[model samples]
Target chain A: MDVTLAREWMRAAAGAIAADADLLTRLDAAIGDGDHGVNLNRGFTAVVAALEKTPPETVADVLIKAGTTLMSRVGGASGPIYGSALRAAGKALPPAAEVQPADLVAALHAGLEAVRKLGGAAPGDKTMVDAYGPAADAFEQAVAGGADLAGAAGAAARAAAAGAEATVPLQARKGRASYLGERSIGHQDPGATSTALIFQALADVS
Target chain B: MKKFINDPADVVAQSLAGLAAAHPELRVDTEEQYIVRADAPRAGKVGLVSGGGSGHEPLHGGFVGPGMLDAAVPGEVFTSPVPDQILAATKAVDGGAGVVHVVKNYTGDVMNFQLAAELAADEGISVETVLVDDDVAVEDSTWTAGRRGTGATLLVEKIAGARAEEGGKLAEVAAIGREVNAASGSFAYALTSGTTPAAGRPGFELPADEIEAGVGIHGEPGRRREKLRPAKELVRSALDAILDAKTFTGPVLLLVNGLGGTPLIELYLIYGEASAYLEERGVAIARQLVGNYVTSLDMAGMSLTLCQATDEMIRLWDAPVRTPGLRWGA
Candidate 1:
């Protein structure tokens, strides 16, 4: 993947977040704060604007800039979580302008690690980590099976959607939804849904 | 939905503008979205700064004045303030005696404040953080990553702010704030959900006769939904929750807080019920405060916070305080 593909992924993610913002908020209302969609929308919108103003030259540069923009622009729990993911992913890009499939796998692994670190959430916590974790594993599996970056991205997207769907039966063990205990079990986790969107956006762009 | 707002997107910014217009003693930084006492950075005095979402009106903002917060940062409605705004507030208020951040225990607020503290320290300023997590509704909730900091926030601010104003060291003031939090407990019930401006709707829908008991300041679901009971019953239930958490002996501070939409008359009725219950139980209500101190935006509810007060706490509570929402002695 090149810088152009990386930038396209971000743009697509922003568009996707904007399109499904209300759905995300409604999901959050059932379990967490009703601002996930709005907050993520605001952050991604800022990311797009920042990219438009000063487009980066490398995949690592684009990811770092996008991460920084999200952290400063989004003032919610999602901000730092997503921001840390992108920044950590950017750091894994191996000092190259173009990202190979192996590089992409490493990037996803780093991103997942960052989310887990920042949120203190494990896979069964019904957080964004649930979707991101599965997506990263799928991406790594696809690359190991000799797939291209686009093929890996498609696999990640499908895995993320499945992971998001899997959250419906979970009792939240972390974040704000943990307060609801058993009540949070029936609702799909909003962060997981949004993470699926991010992976899907990557597939669409890649 | 019938709110006095120009645009949902501009709610926080415009509200800060309105606050700046209404209170000259408080300085509002529209660009940074922080409020500071006009004469802040008092030499040799420890600075007190606290903040959270915009909907919790009198809370961080209204408390920014003499004998209270030196600065308060407001985020978007029901959202935690960004680190930049918090950093600015800390820098603006820091005197030679250092700064103490009174942070609520919500995940976003705690993380943002922690980031700001690291940044502030990098800029050569000393910072201390005191987490207020006194809500007894649940051990953890959706609005909180841990037990929430609720009505007791007001008590911590007033008591700690006074100690800071008296030239106490940052550690000393923070210790007092922690002690106050340790002795305090809160329980709230929501009659209506807080309406999000962007959505123009409440997160939860309740029938006329029902309410969410043990609700958080945000629109998070409470312990259980039940039929709206009489004031005496509700007050007694709230007090029982607190008493179950920690028994208060001797003098105590009772704050009957309105969650924005409740009227003063109704608050007093709740207060009367609570006061009578505590008195009958032989718990002295030494310091009483009633009104919208910590609130969820237009949520028709009330929270009761009781702090077991020591003589020092009572003296600090009665100290001179001048702010937009609270004033005494001075």
Candidate 2:
């Protein structure tokens, strides 16, 4: 919820996508085409590049610019979904003010909604929504349970990781993997795993 | 691996640049994401546009020449080009008569292209579309995600382009597109994994001794994986899968497409196997195409497409076509 902490999460998200490219690619090979890791890496790399080129004046501006950069550069469903998420999160924020726990919850809720809308996918779709939805809920619930910003992000990251791991048992209902039917089972969703990493990276950042 | 690319991110962009440089006969809008013939629309002829993902070279790009497609849109590797890109290409190729879209029936491709059609209509462009779902890999896959739409795309583009260039209306061109969709079926097998530039690795893991049957063009493995079989048996299996339902079908157009990485000799070997099987079944191969009309990155495999053509269909198939990937017209 802290503005400093939330911005750090974005940076860490970029770093996380970069760091685990091979693992993500391996995950993708099992289910979808083995390009998610690299596709997202390139996209987030562009986001980092844009951020470096023009440091935003406000926290919200930072999120919006990063989101737009990813959308413009990322090629697949991940592009629009992640892009809209960041943009929505950015819009939910006050112009140049610090963010509180409630503010962070509100922003992430908007981001999750944007991702759901753009992807036309929902929970149990064996998509990033699986990780993101549970993560957001866990974060809010943890905060309600009297956790602080980092504490909430940590809970969110754990929930996201568990949700991503759980996708191995469920059949995919979205993306190219869905066409594989029962074969899509037993393979961890590359998108959901990468999403879990985003939250994990946020926890690491804190 | 032998490809001349700096990074996966720059492969498509760099390839587009090289394509533009090599072919001055086409006007390339890299930013808008289209390749249009230099003299497009040709005053009264209906426009033809077809595109899908990249990696399948000489497809949309190489096919953008006279007597073929008026415009070709290129998407990122294995991903369908978005609506804005297709719309931009559509407007650029419209000949005042009308425009016909030849779309492969992947859910994403269909959705995006249809959205583009709607966008074009809002801009006052009359666009007719044909959805090709010719791959017999799965039935009602994903509750009518439809067939995978592989292999037969080449036939559709060529035949429909000829009909359009010969003053056929948009509806007629679209009709030919639908006819191919109805009459054609394709089945592919993969002996090796394909490499996507960004991943810097094969798209899937196949055991050294395994072959994947019913694999799609996008390296999505296949319906079943079994021990690798002999070239002849492979062809027999592929043919049986395609021709099992047809009962002495009418005139058929045959295409033996190599799935990249497969040499001409192997393709011919598979063709020999497929041709002999057709001969035994008393199915006349009215027109036969061999070699790679479609490919899956670097996957070592081949798909066979059979289009049971009527007299009208045969006429369209024999029509002249001039494109980098397929050129018969002078």
Candidate 3:
């Protein structure tokens, strides 16, 4: 993706987060402290403002800048987790202004790895990793199959949505939701849901 | 929901402004959202820092002063401080000696503090972290995040702070904090859920005759919900949970802490019941603190923390501490 496409992806993600903030909050209320939606909304809004104030030169720089802004402003677990993911992804990308679909796939894998490292959450742990891991894998597979950016992004978005939905029946084993044990079941994980929204934003922009 | 606040979003900032206005000994950075001792970075002395969500007031912030934490980083209400803020606090409090971070064991708090410590290390500041996970309510196993750090956090901060003030090195301070956390256990029951400023409603609802046992400081649901019992019975249950988790042979330090909305009168009543039960169980209460030292905002509940006190710990506990939330023998 180019820098312009990267900026559009971030803008779309912010818009999606703002629109679905209440839904995310309600999902979190079931098992967590109920601030995921609001926290993400605040962070992404700042990301939009920051990008507008000083637009980055490369796609990697745009992602890194957005990540740093979220890290500073989000004030919760999501900020650091999502921010670290984006930063790691940006760092993984080529320094060139534009990147191939395969490069984006590798960057997505790096982002997913960052999330797993920061949270210590496995795929089945009912965290953002659940959605992110599947999305990254799907994107990589799509790119390997000679798919274009739009086709690969669409595949990743669909995988993320399915992965998020899969969290509804599983018990949480990490984060605040883990405090509920069995009660954490039967509710969609807010982090996974938000991750799905972010991946969908990528697809939308692509 | 009915809190005395100008706006829900501004609650943390406004309260910090008020704290800065009231406590001249504290240097509150409203923008950075950290509070430090006025004369921080005491050369040749280990710097002690502790922090978490803003709702738990008097915790890291109120305990920042002489013989306590050198700095406290506050995040948004019921949220962990960002890494940049934590790194700033760590750097600000780093005397020539190293700095010790006393972190509560929530996933968010631990991750943020760990990130900050790495940042500090990159900047050439020596840093150590002691995690507090003493609550007996959550099951301590691989399946979960482990028992949450609750009332015992106050004990860790106080005893560790005392050691740091006495010129103990960073390792020693962190070791002492870890020891306090290991030797302590806590249990809490909530009469009502806390209302975060952003939410503007109780996090959860409890039937009038029921209570949330093993409730977390952030209003996270506990082990189970049961019908409310008499003060004596409730205290007995809480004590049973803690005492069962760990063995305390010698005299202990008892902290009967009120969760923000609780009154002193009710807390004292809980204390009376707790002490009598402990006395019956032949557990001596050598030192005691009864007040809202650590709290969940507007949560009507109480948590009991008991530290198996050794001579050194007792001596440190008795040391002079001058701060807004706690002041004695200054």
Candidate 4:
């Protein structure tokens, strides 16, 4: 995948988040401040607008711009987490016009690491890290197994979706939902769900 | 749904515009959604800045004045303000003495303010932060992501603002803020949930015969829902919880804060009940304030805050303050 595909992935992710905005918010309302969907939607919409207004020529440039836009537009813990994720991923990539499937794997790993570091949440914390962490691992494994870029993306998406669904039984250990203690167990994490949606978008666009 | 708003999205901006029009003493930056004292950047004095989401009226914004916050950064309802806005406000209000950030201990607010502090330090501005976590409700809550900062935020802001106004150093003001927070405890109960403009619905629906006890300002689930009782019973329960958390023996400042939508008459009634309960417990209520100060958005409820007042705190609390929501001997 190249810079153009990266843009398409972002666009597809934006569309997916927009389509499921209310659902995400409803999930948040169950155990959060009830604005996750609104915040993410606003940030991604601004990112889309920014991308259209000043289209980046390189993969690194596209991702760096997207990260900064998310940092500014999305207010809350998720903003910094996702912003750092994208920025770390972008920084991991060399300034090249195109990126290989292996580069994508490295970028996902960096992004997941950034998210975990910034959010102070690990895989079982019932945060976006839960989904994105597994997705990164799955993508790297698929790439190592010599799967093509699209095949690896599909694998990552499936892993992320399953990871998100798997959050239902785990008690929240981080973020606002953690405040609920055991009560937060039944609800799927909104951030994890959104993460799954983002990977699904990447697969669809690929 | 019947709110007198042009659009849900515009509620905060429009309300800020109205505040600007009504109070010339305060300067409102509509674009950034921050309010600063007209005479800000008071040289040789510690600058105080505090803010949170917009729905809580007379809180960070309403408390901005001579004896309180120098600037207030407001975000969307129930959301923490972003780093840029906070960084801007910190810079705008900074004097040579440095700035004190009065932050509630919610995850978003803490993270964003910490980010701003880092940015400010890079620019050579010394910053001190005081995190308020005084609510005796749940140890953690949906909005807080930790022990929720409830009514004591106002008390801390006011006391710290007074210290800042008195030419206290950044460390001194921040220390006083922390002292206030540590010395205070709060509890709230809601008859109904607050309605966010965007949601167009109440945060939660409590039955008319039931009350949400030990609730936070943002309508997070409290200890439990129980059958509604008389004002005295509710006040007793709230006071008992607060006393259990932090036992106060001497003179204490009592704040009966009306979460918006509660009538002044009811607040007075609640205050009377709360004060009477304190009297029965042999705790002296030294200073008191009753009104819609720190509030949830149109949530029918009230919170009780008790701060163990020092002689210095009382003197500072009595100091002049001029703002839209609070005013005295100006």
Per-residue error for B182 in candidate 3, Å, reads 0.6
Better model by lDDT: candidate 1 vs candidate 2: 1
Candidate 2 regions off by >4 Å? A1-8, A51-67, A84-122, A143-149, A202-206, B1-8, B30-33, B41-46, B82-84, B96-99, B107-129, B143-146, B205-208, B244-248
Best by DockQ: 3
Q: DockQ of every model listed? A: 0.56, 0.29, 0.71, 0.47
Candidate 3 chain B, poorest ten consecutive residues by summed lDDT: B195-204
Q: Give every collision pair in model 4.
A: none
Model 3, span A101-151: residue lDDT tens: 989988998988888887889989999999999999999999899999999
Candidate 1 lDDT score relative to the true structure: 0.90
Question: Which residue pairs in candidate 1 collide?
Answer: A176-B142, A179-B141
Q: Give the per-residue lDDT of model 2 (tens digit) for B137-219.
A: 76554433557778888888888888888888888888988887788888889998788886777777788899888888888
- lDDT per residue, candidate 4, B1-330, as tens digits? 688899887888899999999988899999877999999888888999998877898887888889888999998888888889999999889887999999887777887888899999999999999999998876644322567788989888888888888789889999989999999999898888887776666656777799878777665556677899999998999999889888799599999999998999999999999998999999999999999999888888899999999999899889888777788978
RMSD to native, candidate 3: 1.2
Lowest summed lDDT window (length 10), candidate 3 chain A: A25-34
Name model 3 segments beyond 4 Å from true.
none
TM-score of chain A of 3: 0.99
Off by over 4 Å in 4: B140-144
